[model samples]
Target: MRELTTAETVREKGSWLFTVRDQYGELDEVILVPCDNESGSASGQASTDGGVEAWINRCTHEAQRFDTGRGVPMREGRIICPKHGSMFDSCSGYCDNGEAADTTLPSVDISVRNDGRIVLTDDELTFVGEGGIDDNESDGDDGPASTSHIGF
Candidate 1:
């Protein structure tokens, strides 16, 4: 597990942007939004009171970075994608409007330690960057083909 930031830090800002290297050795950014404190849940979920939730900083529709420039706008416990005015459920990362309708934001698993530190879980550590592999290209072997999938 990778230590992201202190829990207190996230509680103060309500949200934080974390940049980390994926298993592929490429840079990937995740946005951590704090859930309501009254709920006592550390996992990503929207709350009015303020736990931490993590999601890929990119929009699922057009692959646009949600954290670019001024960052995404938060209203009524949701993050609005500036590119297309899509509102994603902050905790679940579900989008129900705009071009991103029915699609959900990729979530990053995380845990808050007793020491008040936020850590990224192992299963959510791998991410493949855009065009990392070509779908039309092959290994050039006609025999039994091998397949492998990488994702966070």
Candidate 2:
């Protein structure tokens, strides 16, 4: 990973980092967060600015990546999975309610450089409220199995 500096943070207000397989290549996208906290018209609302928040997904439950040209974020404040129709809040990247059609999304850690640059790293990411379940993991009945996974 490349070390980020203070000056570089100012240059990239909304910066992103992702791997391109084999650790051979990486891509970054930068956008300016206007006072409204929105980069373009497509995003419905502008959120507050202070810390770094972002969406890391390719599509919604409907399978639509963001329109790079308009800079519209994917599924707005949440990253929804198209395959299972799961929605994960962008801020925490956890499912609001793990219903059949509402699975939680994975969250990547991120940080803000003192100079105002957003830094995304493993340390910055953690599951919201409760971490998402890992494929190799299973939940035991500690609370109330009757209430858990039951939809009203």
In terms of TM-score, the best-performing candidate is 1
What's the CA error at residue 47 for candidate 1, in Å? 8.0
Against the hidden reference, what TM-scores do the models get?
Answer: 0.67, 0.36
Which digits, one per residue and each the tens of the lDDT, describe model 2 over residues 33-59? 212234422223343333345444344
lDDT of each: 0.67, 0.37
Kindly state the number of residue pairs that clash in model 1: 5
Among the numbered candidates, top lDDT falls to 1
What's the alpha carbon RMSD for model 1?
10.5
lDDT for 72 (candidate 2): 33
